[model samples]
Target chain A: MLKVEVDRTQCQNFGQCVVEAPNVFRLNSRDEMEYTPDVEDAELDNVEAAVDVCPMQAISLALGR
Target chain B: MSPPVVIVGASLGGLRSAEALRRCGYAGPITVFGDEPHAPYNRPPLSKDVLGGEVTHAAVAFPQRAATSDVEWRLGTRIRSADLEQRSIRTTDGEEVRYRALVVATGLRPKRLSPRTATLAGAFALRTLDDAAALRNALHPGVQVVIAGSGFVGCEVAATARQLGCEVTVVGSAELPMLGPLGSALAEDVMRRHVERGVRFRMGTHVAEALGQEAVEGVRLADGSEVACQVLVEAIGSLHNTEWLDGNDVNAAQGLRTDSAMRVLRADGSSWRDVFAVGDVARFPNAIYGDEPASIEHWNIPTETAKRASRILALQLAEDPRLDAAIAERFAPVPSFWSDQYDMSLLAYGLPALADRVELLAGKAGGDCVYGYFVGDRMVGVCGIGMRSEVLKHRDEVSRYGHVPIGEPAR
Candidate 1:
């Protein structure tokens, strides 16, 4: 398992992550970012894409959740 | 020791390319060369935050990942030319580097107002961090700033200058500012918003001459009118940094023409397997827009193209079984761009400018609204100001558009 973290302080809710990896990240009705903290190892590619597109550079992924 | 993969231009594209190479399982040596003195830094903020506030390299520098730590970085080294047939590149200082693979990530330089190439002290063009830093000092309260061009940079800088209490007057060639990208309606709204914020515009004209003795004092518009300015900012456009590729047989007339796989193509339409391009430099075909190749200089393009190019390069380097099959799945990256001017947060998916007509999709015309861009019957793009959620819903439609079955010709 890989652990995903988003620094809300830096996040502007650009929703780029939601476009890249919709399964793990989403924008709520208020347009606030809601994301899955833990992701399966198989979701690395998608999660990594999400990290790259985050203009704020807020998303982070690590091994061994 | 074998020759390493050499990537030119050390900005967002170069950094992303190096990182993607590692991600795609290429363990070999990678070297990136850049003309700028500083390491890779984000550029989007240069016109907004950095321009409005204190400008520094640290504030906008992209975070370096551990995976690409071993990648050699040669900053402030200008490559004079490259011989693709010889598989070698010569630096301006007479240094030669034989690269196993070359990634042409050299992006663009801002185009200045012609007829006057002199380096006036107060005159600036906001492309590099240095440009922003220099322009920052002249942007204090009550300074009369004349910005040439009405593109994103021009408008953004106008807004930022207004925020800093500078008197900004934007001179544009088009009837309305940002007419090429944003349609008339949204542009009117944007212009209205800017006007509300006290930013003036001189539409349907261009800066013919920068009038000054030493530092820029004013500009003479092509309309035969003169506006006194304390600072002059030329945000006209950009020229591709492809001059170093002079002797090469590559089609760099526009940007380097590339196949959908990111391989640099020759004038005869043959692609060089080892030479690829990414970011604003690579004019690759987008599936949503059919087979027409274009160089989209959006913020997301660097990371997107770098990842695709790295995947293919890594596979080729490793001699993977997947290499035999021509990339059947065409590179289908959904184009995206965003901008901030005053209180408006502009978000867009796909090339909205490519559309012939734009229709109201959701929300009111004057306020937060979504507009769907259409070509014929298919909705090609979606753009809106403020309605983030509503606008994003059509992202899939834009991605799936133009299924007209147009791609690389049979070759």
Candidate 2:
């Protein structure tokens, strides 16, 4: 399992992360990015893409023990 | 032991660096320091929707899932000293934090009018959210607003004020607005557009002083003309936040000099292994452009540079092949930016400042069209105004390693 996080203080909600991982991340009604923190191992590829596509570089993932 | 990553400046660049570090699978402790109290919010909308009263301050908050990653957010604080040799930073609160890797993203601050003028009740300049909010409150119907500059920020504010039914006048020393970037031909079109929207332009006029006893009442120009207004919004350019690095060997000036990989360069033009810089605070060379170090004040470079910095940090920690050469090439992505003014949406691909020639590819002057700029024979940049589809198409072509054909198309 992987845990994804974003620094709310730094993100500008440009939605570049959503384009990288649509399932794990999304832009809320306020036009800010909303996402689930935990993702299945199978979705690692998309999550990694989210990590790259984020314009504000506002996403992070941690491998569980 | 994995060293803690210290990020200075909680703006887009620093914030993105922290996020990129997590994305790169660094589970080590991360700390972010910001000078402002509020959480990171989108600034583009501040001059638009927020000023137009279409959105509230809370509405601009960038969304993040609560469990994204555990990060130590030190808000309302700033890094007073960065000791690169010791890899430590001292904050304004007297706390010292050591880092294995540091990302400096301290963005620029707006150049203000003299303190005497700024101390006036209604004088304003928009750089942060608070600045925007204050400027927003002063925009009411029939409020005479005198904008000091006609650059991107000034033009945007003028449009917003016009939308709010405020009497707006833009004062600048340029023959045409934005001649420094878009050149005379295009700047003239921009000036025409604003003029058609009821904005008065005082070209070649310099401000002698802002006239007011307690509050902003008018502006005295060099030509001995007084333009009266209730609000004075100065949209002059910005000064990069690099003064804190004084006395350090780091090549610091208007911005920190960096390479393609976003590594901060030393005085002798050597990259600092553990020190990286990004955003408006970094001045670096563009691979596509010439060797001149280009410093973009746009929103895209910071986010892009942060990701590149994160990759380098991860590789260094992992002890991967010290392939700095390969990594630098992969990190140098094309520069792109956009801005929205009134009903027109402008998108620019690549860096136009490096271009030698510009041609109107599809649209009329100021109409819906894609304008292509080139450096020698290569298509370096494209600017689109009201031509979103064409812009996207050309953007895709440019991104795919394509170029604009040598001569004019068979129109």
Instruction: Name the top lDDT candidate.
Output: 1
> What lDDT tens digits, residue by residue, belong to model 1 across residues B87-106?
99999999999999999999
Q: How many backbone clashes are present in model 1?
A: 0
Per-residue lDDT over B194-224 for candidate 2, one digit per residue giving the tens place of the 0 to 100 score: 8999999998987778998989899999899
User: Candidate 1: where is the Cα deviation over 4 Å?
Assistant: B115-118, B401-411
Interface RMSD of 1: 1.0
Candidate 1: RMSD to truth: 2.9
TM-score versus the correct structure, for each prediction = 0.96, 0.83
CAPRI-style quality class for the chain A–B interface of candidate 1:
medium
**Deviation in Å, model 1, residue B254 alpha carbon:** 1.2
- lDDT score for residue B217 of model 2: 92
Residue-level error in angstroms, candidate 1, position B398: 1.0
- Expressed as tens digits, the lDDT of each residue in A1-65 for candidate 2 is 88999989656554556655778887665445688998888888688756654544467778766
